[model samples]
Target: MSDLVSVAAIKDLLTECPICIEHFDDATRIPRRMPCCVQSICQPCLESYSGGAATLSCPMCRRRHNLPGGVKSLPKETVILKTLDYLKIQKGLHLPCTDCPDKEIAVAQCDNCGTFLCSICLSAHKRNTVSKTHTINTFDEMKGRPLQSFRRLHQCSQHQQPVQFYCYTCDKVVCVSCTVVDHKEGKGHNVVSVNEAHQGKAKSINDVLGKIEEKTKRLSETESALQKKIENIKLSMKVARDDINKIFDNLKDRLNQRRTILLSDVEGKSAENLKVTEEALDSTRLLLTKVKSSSEYMRQMRNKADKVEDLQVMGSSKASLNSMLKESPQEIPFDRTGVSFVQANVQHLQNTINVAGMVRSVTFSPTERPNGIPDTAVHNVITLEPAEFPTD
Candidate 1:
């Protein structure tokens, strides 16, 4: 009896449904136990949460429970209802008599008949010859006492006698006569008192609860660590991307500068070569003019002038020819010049460009790593150098 009263105190500690945060009762707010996860939820809350689905998942544990017959198929938490009844009785709330059509408040309960009684019924029961021997206990006596002190034993379905023992093989409660006939000691059935079975199951439940708590804690920590690793991976990618951009940008700037310099050199060389060619052409043309005029004068003097005078003119023309000849047009002041582009180490430079920057992995031993470095941490390196181009 004291044990039942102590167990009833659990209602004050945890009476609310986890989903709706409402207290449970035997009526509309009845508690229903989930077979999958063994969590108790109120009937209305469970129904609404199911949302007409054939499978219902427990709100607390997320374990699925099949609803072949809907929410009604889930077992009711009778122990919780019993505790609620005890609380109501302690508070002096009215409970209806089982036999009263008007629903009169029960003043007492019959232990033998398992019926709540009004004042009038209690007197009539004592006067009845057949039921006068029935054990009767008043509710007033149960105000501060345990409800179990006046509770009736459960009747067996087949024998109609009070069940006294539990059959481990059948997982059922049976009366003494049924235990001897059906759940015998020499048979495969393991029989024990109701109290022993209760203690064993209670211990098993506590052990499982402790393990579940530890597993949940570990999983939460692992999830947080995984999230951090994902963030780190994104950060690493960004850093590598920036490095690649920087390297290519530097290479591009250097290439552009080289192009500009090469173009300028080509232009300057072309201008110098053109000036040399133009001077050579001017010198050769002047020499040609002198030679032509000197030759023509010599020919006219020889053909038309009188003997001695023509001979004198011939000497002067000869002198002019000698002077032109000394100018040597064959040896004109011209230098051979041209512009062309030649690429050096074409294959080698192409190969270098192909592998200029690469993504590489580097590992470090525990001792080689700096302090505070994670074991799973990865590093990235981007390397590039200016190519050495040959001068043209």
Candidate 2:
């Protein structure tokens, strides 16, 4: 019995949902199905295997099964299926028609089962019967090709025929039929042959192209100059960073040396003050003990009465002791003046590149006569001798 129980436990551990074949984490709430004759499967995989059909057939039992309908029976599942249907529609997933290879049949999907059906087969599905009036666009319309405009110079918009002439005054293309109709109607329009108008427009377009090419050359030169200026700015920044770093290193070393000297001076002054205070405290303690002993001696000699003279000596000793106790200890004033270094205010030099100034005057005059011949005929000639300046 124990061996059989162990075997069953091992089998349970290895069991997988037939749909996913990955271990099942839980069976409740999460879409899990126990087939009528087979093991369990996740609901999603089962639905996918059934081709989103209204009726599902179990692979194990070979028995057909109908899915639940309406929001009341399966609200959550129906919502999920409808979402999938919406995505499928957006993706334009179409199945080719079996009857006609070229023609594709549009499917009307059921929101509940995610089932897609052609117009003919949709009549058989009870759930899809209500969706008969749903709008559907054909495959051709879904492609959405741009509309072709008949606005050419020699093309007619009305009859889509070749126009023989251009009505320059009206700026319209017209055929012989339109000229007779439009001209007879007293439209007061000017007309020219299509060939003549085309030639005139061609020459104008070629001249504009030539001007554009010339401007493009100037633009290329300007772009090259701008790029060179940017490179110069980058190089200047690199040099500035390097120079500033060197200055900071030098300043830091000088400050550190000053700090060390100041710290040593402060320590020496503090130690001297501490030693003097200790010596003063020891002297005060010795004086206090001597005075305490003298009081006992004065009491012992009171019978002799000659001790009254010694009272004057004790008074002088008391005065000396009081003076010593009242003395102030000398404190060394610490010098903190040279402890820190003041940083110099370093200013960055502004680098600039001024473009060359323009020429003040550029006079353009013809060097040749009106007949396109060089003007070599001199009108007047002047001969000058040496001139002298007056000496002061």
Candidate 3:
């Protein structure tokens, strides 16, 4: 119940060290505010500022101030530190005991020393005469509330003194002792408070972040459009392939119908010719039989009866033959109706597709198109090439 941060409190959290643009860590991020400009700077920058000087200068305002007691004299910003505490609570962090070897969780935080303590360590700390008067709070009280900003005693690289001031010209954080003993206050060096610097930089970063968000949104839309285009292309190709197959199927049906018709024609014409030839053969056989009968009758008449009987049979046969001859030709003529298929050049038909591929009727127009069509979208000849069928 005590581990929660309010929405209004969340807005007040310090997410990063303004000087380094890095996220604030409890162990490293020590928040310090200068007196002249009331600006907050990280502990590292402060330690670097008070290099060898008894006096410190505000980076933004270039205002100089005396630092009698050094970096420890810098004021603590309570609001900023409270923001850090909220962040720790957000991460569900349990304060670790400083003296514990395994980094055991601590139950209380020392206000004077800024160190967390377990029950054993807390009792020991309380019993000690030095820490007996120090203020201590349970972990529950420490969470969900703003705490005072604390600065570590970081020794300067140059004079081993705590850094107190920031140099504007050099963009370096130095100690107040360095200003007097080492770096004398020089002209053309402008300095101001960390708050003013942090505010200016935060504004600039926000502008960039806004632009990045807009670009990200636009890119997302573009990606969606591209995906739709790809799907559309796939659909069109599938439809085209289906249409091509249907066209070939129709061609095969037509060819099969043509074959059936040709076969029917051949059968009808051959049947008619066979019928005529059969009739002619029957008539000829009848005539031959009659002639043979007549000759046999004549031989019989000559041997037995007389010339009268023979003349009667021969006269009947001659009359019948004359009638048959008068009706049609002596020999039956063969009448033939030829059937053939005119097949196309198979190679030429195959090459026709290649010809279609190379052929293009393009048009260049500067005038506006009629209706709602754009001139840029217009083309004279359009050819569709379908994708290859996937094997696997």
Candidate 4:
């Protein structure tokens, strides 16, 4: 579970655009590298921020960049895109076909229609007369193909025709008929063929790609370091758990030993006390028997005596009985046992138990730690907060 979460955290850090902070996708949110800072920004964010300007400032470093053609000219961050693709494949993910009602996996994409298709949908699409001439590429053939090489046509709203031209003055893509009727050059509109504008932006795009290549190399190194950090965290957790178990196991042994000593002490003293009391009880029973026997003899002699001898025997018996009765039963020695348990300092033991183990976390300096993680302190305790990644 820990490993899964850590890997997800690393992916979240690597796949997000620095500008919009959204995960990069193959469609509108595709990552594009800026020449100024060599930072990856999503395509939609660039389009919105550029706002048809001739130059755009880098969101990270604030360095101005010339948009010779438009945001479309900026090269895609191919490294990040490839990483995302590889991860998706590893996870067994499949993008759904655009034409499938039941969400079938896409096997091919139509360049002309700009829609993905499953095998069944592709067969139907090829059979349709309207789309029979459209250019389609299977997933295998599309591998490593540059995104800019694919041509997607959009229909002009006014003319309902394929847009083939760009009107710089109106800042819109227009069809040939629209250019003639509504966006003519004579009407102060600067219009140019899409090919011509693309050619003009080729040099700038190449320059950005070169910078992005270097940036991606650094990103790769950072990713490797992050992977190492995750492994380290897992190892640390395992070690801590083992330590906790060992300490508690030793404590249990000591407690059991103490308990056995206390029980033995009580049992031994109780046995000794029982022997002493039994001896005193035996002596008491013998003394009680003698007194009762003498009293009965005196009573018989007085009732049946008829001569001087009987009288003499009665007097002697009475004297002896009185002397025995005068002796106090309380004076007989019988020692009582005080064998019991006395509780130790409960609060002290409670305090010791509470502090017996601790989970500690430490923050390392920038030079000592991997990328993505910042040097943030959480004292000397474990915390459950999410890891923060640097945006710039």
- Which candidate has the top score in lDDT? 1
281-327 in candidate 3: lDDT tens per residue? Answer: 44443333333332332232223311222222232233333332233
How many collisions between residues are there in candidate 3? 33
* Tens-digit lDDT track of model 2 for 1-392: 11111112212222334335554332322323322321234455566656776666654333466766411122122111222233334567654332233444646543333234466655545445665554433333433322111011123557655576666565555777777777433677777766666556445433433443443344344334434433433343344334434444454443444334423433443344334433443333333222222222222222121221122222223333343334333322221111111122323212111110111111122233456444675322222222222122
- lDDT for every model? 0.54, 0.36, 0.45, 0.52
Q: Identify the runs in model 1 with alpha carbons over 4 angstroms from their true place.
A: 1-14, 49-54, 99-103, 110-115, 125-137, 144-153, 157-160, 177-187, 213-392
Ordering by TM-score: 1, 3, 4, 2
lDDT of model 4 at position 25: 89
Worst 10 residues of 1 by lDDT: 1-10
lDDT of 2 at 270: 35
Candidate 1, residue 138: the lDDT equals 82
Q: TM-score of model 2 relative to the true fold? A: 0.26
* Top TM-score model: 1
- 1 or 3: which has the higher TM-score? 1
- Candidate 1 overall Cα lDDT vs. reference? 0.54
- Per-candidate RMSD vs. true structure? 46.2, 47.7, 47.9, 44.3
Off by over 4 Å in 2: 1-155, 183-188, 253-392
* Model 1 clash tally, residue pairs: 0
